[model samples]
Target: MSNYPKTALVINCGSSSVKFAVLDPTDGHVFLNGIGEALGLEDARISWKHSGGEKTETPLGAGAGHDKALAFLVNNILADDKALLDSIVACGHRIVQGGDIYSQPTLIDDEVEENIKKVIPFAPLHNPAHLLGIDAARENFPNIPHVAVFDTAFHQTMPPKAYRYAIPEEFYTDLHLRKYGAHGTSHMFIAQEAAKMLGKPLEETCLITCHMGNGASVSAVKNGKCVDTSMGLTPLDGLIMGTRCGSIDPSVVFFLCERLHKTPQEVEKIFNKESGMMAVSGVSSDFRPIVAGIQEGNERCTLALQMYAYRLAKFIASYYVPLGHVDAIVFSGGVGENGPTTRKYVCSELEEAFGIKIDNDANYKARVYMGVDHQVISKPDSSVKLFVIATNEELMIARSAMQFVK
Candidate 1:
């Protein structure tokens, strides 16, 4: 352990993309970050950066899943710096589904890895990709430790009522089908940072943290513990996002099968990939284009945008009752950090209901970049505070790794 680099390698593997980050464990400083994409259903492309501000990109292989992509990513990113790779004492993987098997970041071994695989049925789209990332990293650095930093770990504090559906208890007891919320790390990081900016003790801040990226989720944090969250068992169960149709009635699946004549898996593909604002406005998933159309008199885009805001506001307001008096609202992730109009829209309707309000001018200007400072969007007299906090889950992982290295 003393000989290994005091650095930790972090991997976040999505369905089509693999994002890697290297951080100094002692200080949680990101040395460099990069992504590899398996786009167009063809050969994969890889890219990475060095701390010297040098970046490199190339093709790794074709049509391989995340595991192969991970191997190729290491080859291109760390090949020139064998010493750096050797210094990576641990690998922290961002797993989408932790289920009841884990409540925090756990060191991965043969038994732990097998247990993670057992939860695959609970998160079919996510768990497999995570395993691939783990295997790839282990294959390259077999002696190093690998830890699973679950997206659901931070929400493990959710009490039974908040997590359990109104369905039969047998399903939960026997099949473990209860809600295991995702995006917990993002919610935890954003909420704490927002509370810090407001000079409030994190445990005293009753916050609603919106992690709105391509995948979106809203969490209700009262005193630093997640009480309730928008995303249910999967990332697909939140507000309408880039490609996911969030919070649809369960019966919609039957409608897809009977009325649309599609099988369950086919319908799953639609909700996970083709639906949401893209399907509603008939525009691209990237909100930039959809927002541009808003200025071009596109009624469909306007309606889609309205639905997005209305849905987000509804959930945020609903949690106010469960959380008691709200202290601050925090926004993070791709859209939440940069989409001021979206954040503004979500906050506007809540002004009358939850005493929530934000300055549109500040929001638009604040979003010039994601990691910018805390901008006070709330009015001086407004009871509730609103903020944009940049989340750093990679650093969180590195810090967790440090706790174990000694």
Candidate 2:
């Protein structure tokens, strides 16, 4: 790898997919990106695309997990690609959980990697996946300095009163049961990006960033640090998501296990995999069809949409305090950036309280494109400015990686 400040590779790992991007940190230009998925099953398809329109597609087997995928990236994606290999300076990893430490973008050392591994229990779904990616990178490109940009990193500033649970006092100091929010990388990216779009300094802006994807969360960022967020100890503690039940009552667990004769695992399965929009609508987990059903007068679909929008609006309203006054409500991620209908409903619900008005015409006109982008869907004179900006977590990770090399 070249010792340079301009180039860094960013890796993002999911339960079944690993996405990568190569970027020039000097002026924030992305050169290449790719994804490998359909893991743990046969005929896994790995695809790589360069900024120059060159495409490479390979077919691997079910066991070609994240490590193997990275091997593919290094061997093929970087082999014939002279520019990528020549300029590659450092690597960055997108880690999903940081537990209590909420470490900022840090140079990934043995201790730091082990620290991430320790939180696997808290983030069973994501931390293990993150470790796999980290290990893969370590094995494939041992020379490249790596940095971990935590999904929880940006939220470490949350006050004890806001993040702590009311259970036992020891839970805070001992077990780390307090809220260690996730998707903070996305929140951090969009919030700072919004500051630029608004022509305001990051330290002067207060933002509530709503990251709506298969996983979802809303963070109240005050003066560039997260003070309150919808996500709690785990990603399960927020607004409703694809199949995950977000923020259910603690009593519901007892109701399922004690009263319904379901085991803890069985009850957990219900909440983590069998609930939310899928259970409520009885339709696909995707919001596209669910949103489509709204026009056709489908009751279940309508209720699902209502639940999603209402919860989002509720959280957005609650974040007003931590933000002091609330300068803007920034939306990003899959559903947040693309779902204008949902954005409309969410903003309209708070129109009276926040004096925010989304221009329906502008929202519907927004397109789906990558990189950083913004749209002010609010009335020209709205007090609480509403913005929908595309997120770039991987690029943020890349910049962190460059710092690691430095």
Candidate 3:
């Protein structure tokens, strides 16, 4: 066995926080993982843990941001172990938007950085934070290769018919206003894992991957490539999310502005931050609380769960047009991996329409928290198989980074 270092450092920076992990690209084993949150606030802090070790935390002091967090990662976290630091062969950055230019993971360079910057308007809050992290990581670890893994890259395979909006030609031609799905990394990871669990070659497998989380999307992966996805030009166009309303009438915007006398920005906020499960359930956006409310006989919570499942099932059935025959339906992401009740509700809706005979016992048991990474939750006689596969975007990013390291 080669003892040479084969680890990749994965960085996911947000507007005010940084999430990082050092893991082996080969086995998906995390060596260290941490988060630095509340940057530029009064109580900025970072917490981390070595593999199989107790977690440790430290305050980064006020006004600290990406640079200070990354500096702490190098100076205090990895400094004591030279071997660990040396083992890092690549740095993988999670970029939320790549616009139309990149279809795959690209090695980070000055030009690549500029391209990312150009897409800032598409991912205003996320891309800038990613750039900050990239710059900081480059300064902190100048020796290793850095790679950008875009969240929209996988969905770039969609045909024009699937991605195009029915607006004026000049809108798309001038401003590039078309569908660009989110959760590409998760969908890609789930498709690959679903193929493995089904014991089929990736190129021969067809899947409808439902990444159900606070922010959710459904994707049609036909023969190892994304043929269509639920999300559009922005995540706001997709399935009803935790806070964002999905796929509403276009005229509602004008209604809110003209009749309600609301500004564009306020209407935007209403769509993005004041709707979906939170607004429908009158409960927390987190699924747990909503589920609890259902148990307590809260009618709105029940309605919310019904709406969520219905929307998900509708998307799954609609994907049948893109993928003629699905080999499996994969459930992934935070809610998909753990929300058994949600899975049950959705599967019940799909059973009659799609001939999916889900095994209730198996579905409830297939949870990542229970150490079940892969589970076949369908009966053998079912026409379509069902699976719950845990997603690992960090591992996917690490593997992508490793591909360019040599």
Candidate 4:
């Protein structure tokens, strides 16, 4: 076994998959990472890799689920390396919605699990899966502390003016119908890294961070806290996403349900599952295929790409209201870090409107392939700096979990 620093086991559990990693919180050194996929299916399987090692896969028996998959993770994978298992100081679980109650990572106890259960309606698909993973991990690693790192935690700092909708006061007070932004973990990580790149303290930096992926959100951070963000009540309220309809008029839902004779659930499925780039481009939700279609002269695909960049740029520009003196505009996530074409379109829009210059050569070269974790994409003389900072949510989770290690 290699010499390893104290690490945290980070778990991001979904309905059918559990992504896990063991990483040192100090320098973000990953010791191992893997996933338990296709849980509860006939082909339920687990795949993993030790640091600097080849991937190995194993198939669990038919109908295996979270409990069984985590059992295999503990008994088969982690057990193989005694030192690695011993180095685990804590377990961190990523939770999607913590409501207004949890503003920071909390030590997981019976009370915390109960609190997660209370917010089930806000994140029906994610919180239960997280609880399952938490239960399984706690069962396996009984000696170590378990912490909950919420995706909504960082955005909880948003003031009432930012989070509250213009609805009736009773609705917000009684039902909690307020914005609870997602991707807080990614936003927080990028903000910290961007501050480091800017050679300033995080508390002194003002940034508009855009995290664009299959699911996308932009946040405005001023003086080290979230002042405002693009996403709202749910992730579907944000900028256009792979399959989600971003911000649409409320009447559209009524029009579809009342006039077109569709149920609320059906309309929800249409907006959440059958919209965005897929509906716009008549191509796959994946940007790669849409780009290919654009190359082949598909107008729909061209419109899709244009809409994606335009909507994203508009969100970033809007955040300028909250962040008066912007230190930088950060682009991170799958599409943000890798898609130079999208970045060009977005930065161009900002340039025309706000004079945020984008260096064509620098923007083209700043990407995952270039092996730079963070790089400025804007010209030196630009009014506001632009950056392509790769986000690391797992490491952030590990760091949060580390806080409870003692």
Candidate 5:
């Protein structure tokens, strides 16, 4: 291995978006960060910025796709700055589902690529996009090593009891179906950060990590290992999110199909794309607007907020049964870091029962933009601590890739 410090290029691809970051893993210094969005659409565009520099957005004509967009990022963006491109040592791709086959980051090869393709059914919306970005990056930079960092890897430590669904045995044995949680990267990152803040070794720490955003999930981390998580089999099984109706009863699907005369695919679309906050509030899926609607005396919005908070609190309390004694409850991701009202609402009922009193003043200050990514929002005398930590999945992916390169 070379002694010189080198940057790691991290790629995260969604159905219609591609986010890339180049960072120096040793010091966590991001060199360049950008995204290409609205792929294949008339309004497709790419936006990027150098560290400490103003952002630049460029429109890509209607035919632009992932490969074309990635080429632009490399040939037009990084190529303009040769030094930065030359310093890149490896590439890391964030893969959503690795299935039971991959329990850790694996160096990508023909076999690994085939395995990734095989698991596409488990992550229909994510894995294909990831493969596109992976293939594009590999072709764009053929010399460097590339790694696939799975979002489901960290939660592989979950016990069978926590992951197993009470379904037919053949479904699991033949199809490899079970509750493989999502947001493992974010959950693992925050759990370690929370352990550091608590002045305890990760192996001895117990934490409840809430990764709340447009997509949300909570994990119970016991002594550095994941015990249980809210999301299961797919991301749709988690807490209520921007569009997903998390943890709905299976019978609801039957009702939609048999009673309402809706097809399975139609019901699936409604649950995954048209429900949750958007369905309940009938205003917006975003938390800010939902909270605003509550303040404006919208009953549906108020009920939506209450239901979201109640479910989150219930998950937190339920995890306590497995953890026995808790050290801290960590709030991370988009909404968790900025939405103090949501945080307050989530802990409202648990304050007395679980000793999770939120320090209103401190809770209101934990915003990523304010340089306060890590903060303790719990009352000083409270038995259980509460923290808000910014989740850094890209950095974590970079570090994971570094281990293989080194």
Candidate 6:
């Protein structure tokens, strides 16, 4: 190991899962990475893999919550690697929604913790879990500096016009009701990477970033700042996701309540958990199965894929309004980087309209160069360039956290 400390512990705690990684941010190498999942119930388990070893899984005890799960990870997996643990100088957390108060990675303090608690209403499932992870990790590794990296921090650069809702002013001013986009860290990272790929300064580059996965969102980055994004108020407002009904008419809720006799809670559940590709394809929420179904002559799956691509294309086109000229259209996240068919379909519609022509062979070859680095897929003569960049939210978190410790 180097004489100076060069590692950071990154924590991403979800509603029922805790994902942690020990990384060397300078070289982008993961010493150890793992996740504790199925939290708070029997059969809760922790699985992890070392850099050069096979993955290992162990059953956590019954009723293991986020705190207990993180404790087990630090005590069991990380404790054995004293060198790696000792080299870690900071801990970075992924806070889903920071509301309007936070705009950057903040050092964890009592006031910071309180503000995070205050935003629970905006991120009911995520904020509470993040608090658990933060509390547990702080206690488990008391000496290290801890930082809260808000996913909304990057999009804080969005102007009022882009983030504001059309409701009464008080709703936005008092109730804090407005668009606070998600996947901001991914979008920011990809935008910076795209700037580097173009050999231009980030402050002079303009780009559109598509972060597509189980949860999808697109952002318009003008001169390296987020001017607008697709997701609104919550992650549910973006492009159709694995299960979310993205960007539907607000009146649909009232319609469901009146005609279907569904409660508000029931309607929320349906929109967040029962819609999207799962409902459209009528098979599974996973894209792999949906794509497989399409190959097997399933019309519903075919339509689902088409609709997903269409919405993405439309969003890509609309973002151009904010960014008068885009240097590149970047694809990140799980599906964005790996789903060539989806990428092909999304670009096919924009080919003539946007002067973007995909090189089919280059698109297929790009999958081979997925993580950290990016691969360009648009033809040389195409007016607009297209690229597939693997997003590294953890690395971004680590980099932010490192600044505070320094």
Which regions in candidate 4 have their CA more than 4 angstroms from the true location? none
Per-candidate local distance difference test: 0.82, 0.84, 0.92, 0.92, 0.91, 0.90
> Each prediction's TM-score against the native?
0.93, 0.94, 0.98, 0.98, 0.97, 0.97
Query: Candidate 1 lDDT, tens digit per residue, 332-370?
Result: 888887888788778887888667768777778887374
- In model 1, where do residues sit more than 4 Å from their true spots? 1-5, 26-28, 39-42, 62-76, 368-373
Better of 2 and 6 by lDDT: 6
Worst 10 residues of 6 by lDDT: 364-373
Better of 2 and 4 by TM-score: 4
What lDDT, from 0 to 1, does candidate 5 have?
0.91
What lDDT does candidate 3 reach at residue 97? 96
Give the local distance difference test score of model 4. Answer: 0.92
Q: What does candidate 6's lDDT look like per residue over 50-167, in tens digits?
A: 8889999999988788888888877878788777777889999999999999998999988999999998988998999999999988999899889999988889999998999999
Where model 6 places Cα greater than 4 Å from the true spot, the runs are 1-5, 368-372
Per-residue lDDT tens digits for candidate 4, residues 298-373, read: 9999999999889988888888888888999999999999888888878887787788999989888988757899
Candidate 3: misplaced stretches above 4 Å? 1-4
Tens-digit per-residue lDDT, 1-406, candidate 5: 1223689999999989899999989878888999999998999999999988999999977968889888998899988888888888899999999999888999999899899898899899999999988888899989888999999999899889999989899999999899999999999999999999999999999899999999999999999999999999999997999999999889999998999999999998999999999999999899999999989999999999899999999999999888998999999989999899999999996987877788999888777769876889999888889999999999899998888776
Give the CA lDDT, 0 to 100, for residue 30 in model 1: 70
Cα lDDT tens digits, model 2, 133-165, are 888888887888988888887888888889888
Q: List the residue pairs that clash in candidate 6.
A: none
Model 6, CA-based lDDT: 0.90
